[model samples]
Structure formats: structure tokens, C-alpha cells
Target: MPNPWDLPDELPTDLPVSRCELPDGRVLSAVQEAEAHTLWEEISSAAPYRKAAEGLRPGEAVIDVGAHIGLASLLFGGLAPESRVLAFEPAPKAYTCLEDNLARLLPGATAFRQALGAASGTSELTYRPYVASASTLYDDAEDDARNLEAHLDNIGADERTREVVRRTFNVSQRVTVEVTTLASVMAEHDVDRVGLLKIDVERGELDVLDGIDPACWPRIRRVLLEVHDIDGRLGRVVSRLSGLGFHATVSQWGVYVGGSVHLVLAERD
Candidate 1:
């Protein structure tokens, strides 16, 4: 396979490219250098999905919703090398980087350039070029800004860093993208069992969960998602998962203390 991630001959020239060298000496590509570092630290160093991914069986699939630039998928592939990876990313730039990264780093992994939601159709996605990871289908500018500010305060980020982040979220472009449901994807791919379903779709986490068919719930062994607990969404998600026979646990990291963001780890009971 070609190693474009190492040499970058096939990458787009118009968009800025950022590469981070993992502790394992593997180079990953992204649109922003700082974001790339942060993703690597969270996905590889911190390893939030480690526990959920541990249950992966050989030939099972690991589904990554909101995969961004494929950092989390890369981690999953490392944690469960025998399993397959399927990543979904809606934003054009981010999806491009994700497709490239997975193609070069994870040869057989599949990348989809569509958003997963409650129903399959076309939707307007808010794409933040500066902060590509923050792009989402739910475009609540005020709430997003406030949440980011709180998160930055909780992390004690410097004023310069705060200003830069604020600016990144301030400007965004709306793009029409194809949307599909998780159940549809599973059926299409003939994925009989999902070892781990990792979701990080900004504030649209609930919608992604709602998209999963009731029949498919039994196929998902574990789910790890970042939920923005706004309007009692956290409670609803927990209840829904629990009803579906999952034991869910919620925790907050220091970086998200002042904000409503949290991590929910769910395993089949």
C-alpha cells in the first residue's frame, strides 16, 4: 500500500495539513496540528475506548461515528488488530483527511463521507474549517460557544489560546451532506456484530443513538460516546441504553468539568 501519510504526495494542497507523530512512532495526518495532538493524546495516550474495545472478537467490526481524521479509528485498529474498522465523517476536509489516513495507515478500513442520524436523508452540516473536529449537524452557535468557553476555563487555557478557539467556532460554513442511519449502514455492510461503537458527533450524539434500529441494539457489544448533557439528554440516553440491556456509566474529564460534556461507556448486560 502507498504511504501518503508519510510523504503526503496525494494530499490536498489547498487545505493546510498537520501531522502528529504518535508515541509508537506512527505519523497521523489532520487539518490542525493542535487538534491532531489533542486527538492523539485522548485516543492513544488516554485511551478512553480501551475498556470497551477490549471485548472485540476476531473478525468483528469497530464502528467509528464522527471519526474526524481517523485518530480514534487508528487507536481501535491498534487495540484490536484482528477486527475491522468502519469510519464515518461528514465534513469534506475532515473526511478527506480521514479517508487518506485510514487508506495509508489502515489499508482495509472503510471510510464513509456521510453523517449518521435518526433518519436517512440530506441535512445541513455546520463545518468549521478552523476547528474541524467541532463541526456537526446540530449547529447551535451560542450554546456551542458557551460550552467551549466553559471547557477552556475548566482546562485553564491561556487567553491567547481561548481567543483562538473562540474565533474558530465563530466562523463556519453550512454544507449539504448525505445522512444515513446506523442500522442502514450495518445492514449494507453485513456487519453481524459490532465489537465497539464509538461516537463523538459534537452535540448530535442522541440523534445518532436514535438512528440505531432496535434489532441492531443486540448486535452492539459496547458503546463509548461523548455526550453534551444539554436539556436532559444525558439522562435520556442512559435510560434508553439501559432499556436496551446496556450497563451505562458516565464520567467527566478535567477538560470538560465546567462544560456539560461527558463520556458515557456502555456495555451489553
Candidate 2:
């Protein structure tokens, strides 16, 4: 299947592909990068159906952590439209682009421009907007860019760029949106059943999962995650989930930051 993400040239040879709504289905395609928007399609979370399918079924509660320019949400919406999707994004500039993309593709989707961490209070997702390729919130942008070092340097990555600290990726766009554990979110929303829960929170995955309770673990049937470039976070996640009684695995898929993300599955018990 074609990647649902609209790539740099996904717009085709047609010059300046602005917004166009098809007559029959009303698929409004908008081109953001063409107008020098400076955003890149994160292969990490954009497409890859298996990543989205892992531990996923109908009417599931799928949480998208660090959902930048939401292609995963679009996939979940398509796969499980009836499911409740909490798409979290934390970059102001990128979140703006995310809104534009979601409005055009997933109007029914709920957008949370905040970061989801283990402790849940707050943490910085150190980044270099100049290195848009490595903007996955909590992960080290430098390391994630190692693979794209050459290509990105030609386009972006400037040593002279200014640096700043932020609690949310979108500090200016902060909304103090309710922060809750995956368990808390489900209970509040009256989620009797959770089909799939996906997290791509950079290095924050370790902390996020660690924050959950043993009871909450079993409630989730499947878990797809983009593990950080840490020593044992990936293994810890699989072990923890498996211990809670669900089959899990690290899947093979191209990602912008970090290596291939892990696709851990935990079947309902």
C-alpha cells in the first residue's frame, strides 16, 4: 500500500499544488512544503500500516504520542474510524502544519498539542527546527539525524541556529490540555475496551510506559511504539508488556529519527 503521508513531491509535477477538493469523495489535498513551509514528511510515523495495525482492532483507543503532522492518526482513522484517537503534538510550528494536514484529512480527529511522557508532569523534547528531520520531541535530534546527516546538512542543520528550552514542543501554542495516564484517559472516556495503543514519544517511551500501572497494561491488547535510541528501553517495553500478558515484537519500518521502531503486540487476555 502507498504511504498515506504526503511526501515532498507527493504533489506530482503539477506546479504549486495548493488545496483541491475532489468532487466524488471530497479528498482535499493540500501542499504545505511547496510554499517553503520547511517541514519534512517523518517516515517514522507517517505510513507503515503494520505499525498501526499491531495490537489494533475495531473500536480501540489508540493514543498517538508526539503526533507531528499526523499521518499515523490518518491511518488509524482509516483503519478504525470508530476508535478514539488522542493525537498529541508538541511543536508550535509543526503543530500548525499538523492542524492543516488534519483539517484536510482527519476533521473528526482530536488534536492535543502536548507531549506524553511517563511521569506526565513535563519534560523537554530537545530539538533543532533547522533539523526538522529529527523533531520527534524527546529524542536527541543529533543522533536521529545521523542517518540523514549528509542529506539534511545540504538542506538544513545550521550550527549557528539559536537554542532554547521548552516544556512543550509548541511552547507558544501550549493549552495546558489535560495530562493523564493511558489508564486515566481510558477511564475518563469510559473506554471499556482498548484495542491498540501506539506511542512514538522519542526517548520518552521508557518513562511513559513505566508510568502505567499493571492493571492498565492488561487493558491494552496491542502496543506499537517508536523506541528511543537508548540501551534497554525497547527491551524493557517488550518485557513489561509481555509480562503483562501480550505478545510483542520490534517491527521493521523506516523512520526519520532513531532506527526502526518496535511493534509490540499484547493480545487480550
Candidate 3:
């Protein structure tokens, strides 16, 4: 079967604002050309994540950690409209797009313009233009770029090689952003139980998971994370979830020089 994510190739041109309805009826608004591909991938190849949100009951909650521009949040809302969605994203520019998209796509949902980390405080984020999705809280922007280049070189796929050279090889900037913990946010919102907790905080997956209070572990029914083991956190994450009685299912998505990418789905026994 042809991957749905393989859409028609389009020239990268800065669009002030572009709006499109996802196959599921949720709206995605991209503020820059850099965000276009991210939106496409989210809408097109989102079967697994969508499956994770299924079986949700009305009034249940879904938490989107590192919800860059609200892709997963919107997806969750569309998949389970009766369920509430709360999204957390720290990048200012992306937050704006997130807020706008959520308000139009799922008005009942919430958006938090703060990064979720191991503690509630503030941290600096390396903002990369033309590739905002690669922004990370772990400060591995340069290392990530180098690894991506190395992988593209080794893959030897002409189309992917050209895409990488055109996209990931871009400019970056740094800025400080507010940070908070999942436990704290849950308490602030008076949330009792979470049906699904999806995390994609670049290389800071473990930090985000660490912020969850141990006491609240049972409150979370499922956890889906895009894990980057740059600091050797993959094993720790799997072990932690396993200790919490979550049967972990891991899918190795891609490989790079310094580290590999994985998607981990952990559900309570």
C-alpha cells in the first residue's frame, strides 16, 4: 500500500498562513513553510496514534506533551470528540499556531504555552527555523543535524537525500521558555484521570515522563512517546513504564549517528 504521507511534492515557499482540513475534519493551519511537512505527516500517517486514542469514553482526557502546533491534539480531538484534549507547547511561534489551530479545530480543547519537563520552572529552547519540528529541550540541535546528515548520506536515497539537504540543513536560534511538569498541570486543571498521554518532546522524553508524579501513575491509562536515546534514556523509560505495570511495545522508527528514534506505547496491565 502506498503510504498516505507520501503527498505530492511542493516547492518550499514561505506562506504567511495556510489552512487545510484533515481527512478526519480537523483543521490544520501552518504559519510558515517549515511547518507544512510536519502538518502533512501528522494528518497523513497517523494511524497508530489514532488507534491509541480509540476506546476513549466521553469526559475522559488526553494530554499532548510537546504538542508542536497542535497536530496530535487536533488528531486526538477528532478521533475522540467527546474527550477533552489539553496540549502543551513552549515555542512561542509554534504556540501561536497551536492556539489558533486548537481554537478553530476544537474549541473545547486547551493549549498550554509551556514546555513540560522534569520540573516546574524555566528553560532555554534552541529554536530552529525552516525545521521547527526538530526543536528540542535537550540542547542537541547541532548533534541532531549532524546525525541526520550522516544518515541521509548512508541511506543513499536520492529523494530523501535532497529532502534532508533542503530541510534539516537550515538555520537555528535560541530562546528561553517557561517549563512545567505534567503532575503540576494535572493538579492545576483538577484532572482526575487521563485516557491517553502522548509525548513527543524531541530528545527530552524521559524528562517529561519524570515530571509525572509517581502517585499519579495509575491515573494514566496509556502512554505514547517518541523517544530519542541521545542520553541513554530509552532503556530507562521502558524500565520505568514496566515497573509501573505498563506493557511496553516499542517500534524502532529510524536510525541516526548518535542515537536512534523509537515510538513506545505503554499501557497498564
Please, what is the TM-score per model? Answer: 0.91, 0.64, 0.83
Candidate 3 clashes between residue pairs 3 or more apart in a chain or in different chains? none
Extract clashing residue pairs from model 1: none
Evaluate model 2: give its TM-score. Answer: 0.64
lDDT (Cα, tens digit) per residue for candidate 3, span 102-131? 898789999988999889888988776556
lDDT (0 to 1) per candidate = 0.85, 0.54, 0.77
Candidate 2, pairs of clashing residues: 55-222, 90-169, 90-170, 92-170, 118-207, 118-208, 125-137, 246-266, 247-265
On lDDT, the candidate that comes out on top is 1
Off by over 4 Å in 1: 1-14
Which candidate number would show the highest TM-score if scored against the true structure?
A: 1
For residues 191-224, could you state the per-residue lDDT of candidate 1 as single tens digits? 9999999999998898898899889988999999
The local lDDT score (0 to 100) that residue 42 gets in candidate 1 is 68
